[model samples]
Target chain A: MRPAVRQKLKRRFAETLDLPPSVVLDQAVIHIFGDSEVKIVNHKGLVQYSTACVKTRAVQGLIEVGGSELEIAFFSAQEIKIRGRIRQVMLK
Target chain B: MTQLLWLWWQGYLTVRLRGAGIERLLNRASQVGVALFRVERLTSDVVLVRMAARDFRLLRPLLREAVNGPRISVSVLDRHGLPFVLRRFRRRSFLGVGLGLAVLAVFYLANFVWFVQVFGNQALAVEAIKTAVEDAGLRMGIPRSSLDPARIERKLLESLPDLVWVQVKNRGVRVEVHVVERDEAESGEQRAGHIYAKQDGLVTELLVLQGTAQIREGDTVRKDDLLISGMYYDHQGRRQYGAARGIVKARVWYEAVGEASLVRWEPLRTGRRRSRYLLTVGPLTVPIGRSLPRENHLVTSRTWQLYLGTAMAPVSWTRLDYEEVEWETVPVPAAEAEQNAYELAWESLLAQGVDRERVLVEKRAVENLADGNGIRVTVRVEVLEDIGRFSGQ
Candidate 1:
């Protein structure tokens, strides 16, 4: 009935069924490739974009990517591809 | 790279969005099933993003709605991919037509034979094989569709009885003909024979591979003289006769005579010249210029033909240059006349199968004619070569 109760039940079922948290808990999957690219799968939308930083709305919160020459290589309803000198990834 | 190609194939544009909340525009575009790529913030209020050409119309409403906060104006920065390329090509249709014609030319020319190659032939003359191939209708400039490799192979096998197997391959513009000649020994057609001297020579080297030596090295032999006898004694000391095989190399002398006149009539170009052009198709010739006088003229002609790669077309262009000449009596110097006579004699000696590389000695003799009008020169060359010729016993 409540949003917290619904999330807690979903996590418990995911743990019991041995399912991945990103799939069952409705969380964005962040994949970092070396230091030049970051792929946020199951993303919500774009929040902000800059050459030095990029932010995309994920299921949990805002996924912020910080680097030099940061670019949103691709932005779709399903994913956000960020490519640059990726130094840090933060959830806000 | 594949993603970039797909975007290009679908046609896309880079647009500069002049607004504060450009990310919202991208998010809205994405929510409406329109993909955006290469999003970069140029300044605080301006962002550049790439979207499919078809999705730009869908974003017009979104841009208009953003006017309430900050006027979001869109301007195309660049256009890319197939749709734009086709539009440009539509304006200049000649380029497309030229490209199409070039491709068609290549396709059409590929159907004609550009080269005829023969392979895997040993103990058979290349010219002979080429002649047989041409006789079988597989030659340069022949259409690939009309060529039946099976029929050509059959014809080659029939025309050249020595060829046991033949394969005609049509490789694009080139036709490759492969032939396997029948070996006499392998076919059990080896004959019992004696190796004899084919010409008069002094034997220098003798090797008995399957024969008894009839004459030793350094011995002189005449034409038709037997050098290796087929008769021999086997291991059991029994007399046996079979095919005799051996190499008999000898020093042979070739002689030729050349004569030159002391006084000769030489033709000199009189500085008057005429030009003529002719078109030749197969054996038919059509003159394109005025006919020339028949007598006292030296004619030099050069022929030009159309060729695509290695294939020759049937048509040819010929340019004939005629120079008027005047006959003048010139006295030949003794030394120059002798040199000319020697060159003539040497040419004849080469025609008699004299190996220039193997020549051990050369001698020249000059004799003045009795009438004092001409000089006769004789050339003799000695060379080492195999003089063995097999004769069936």
Candidate 2:
């Protein structure tokens, strides 16, 4: 099947089974704690990292976090935790 | 936090990477399960990361590949955790040996009795109980493994006839010896004895528990006079001898004399005071200042001695305070003199063991001196008390 059709089918299946979209679609689960920290589960990899901004590749697109003194606290195959003054979280 | 602790327990290293493709390096490292943590970018091309020490060796080849392929520089900043700590101590091995020896010394010393304590002993002497315990092979510094508390208790009960029950408790480094003494009345057994008068008194009450009553109530008896006899006749008229036990309450008299001068001389402070110091080493006394005769002065001396640990040294320093006094004669009224004499006489009576609660009657006599300079007083008190003394035959 095509990628678009597969994603549509996974979304419908998640709604029918009462399951989370992230679990069904293999999507990145973003968790923001106030404006200081962000945790991304099922992350792909780090694309670009700097003090003011951190950009990571997700399943469908790229996740960019803009803030001051942004740091990649830790990263594994499963998740990535970013901490600092996270002013904006943009999905591209 | 648990992950951080786990990483620390497994040992870890902080590596600083100076390169342009640090992000790719981190992504590749995480993909291979290297667990890159605390990835902070210092500059555009400089980043610091932390990874487990075990993963560090695996990362070495990857680092060499990165250095050769992408020209990345990897330098370890710090090494932490138990493995590195042990590696550092491998040089100063004597310190570990000393610590082990110290622990061994403590363990060895703990196996010996350091303190021997006696409890629940009122009538029995503590030193006598300790002596008994020492004789029973349980004393200070004795090995705990060699101690037999039951045997010690048995030996203590055997050696001290006064004790009815004994218990020896070995508690860690302390040995506790508890003893219960036999009551005097309860211990009156088959030993033949006679109950005698402890003092001269008129017997007012008598109750005999054993033996035969030799003295009746209201009978006057002297000290050492037999009040009860161990010799008695049974119901079959056969003669028997046993311990004599009885309570003999009596009315005893105590007399005391006191004298007071009518013209009393009082010492008045003359306001002249002097102080001198003296150092005494055993029997030798050395004066620290000018020594003056202590005549006609009230002297108050305080002594301080040097002590080494719990033992006192022979060296001592004394500070003597002397206040000069002058004697002045004051005329005392007869009534005041008689009152003073009475108080003094009563003090002497009380000192002779005359119980105030048991006192039935008191008598005092006052007489003027032959030269009319002083008065003499005599006081007498009678009290009801037990005056029985048992003499074993």
Q: Score the docking of each candidate (DockQ).
A: 0.54, 0.59
Per-residue lDDT of model 1, residues B204-281, tens digit only: 999999879999999999999989988889999999888888899999999999888898888988999999999865
TM-score of chain B of 1: 0.55
Residue-pair clash count for candidate 1? 0
Candidate with best lDDT = 1
Instruction: Write one digit per residue (lDDT tens) for candidate 2, span B1-393.
Output: 998999878889999998778888788888888887888888889998999998877766777767556778888999988788777678778887787886566567667776788998888889988888889888777777898998999899889999999888766666788888898766665468999998999999999988899889989999999999988888999999888878999999999998887888788999999899998754579997766666678889999966544434445799999889988999999999998888888788888888889889988899998998988899988999999988776
Give each prediction's root-mean-square deviation over alpha carbons.
Answer: 18.2, 18.7
**Model 1, residue B331: what's the lDDT?**
99
- Relative to the true structure, how large is the alpha-carbon lDDT of every model? 0.86, 0.85
Predicted complex 2: CAPRI docking category: medium
TM-score of 1: 0.58
In terms of DockQ, the best-performing candidate is: 2
Which candidate number would show the highest TM-score if scored against the true structure? 1
Relative to the unseen true structure, what is the C-alpha lDDT of residue B12 in candidate 1, on a scale of 0 to 100?
A: 96
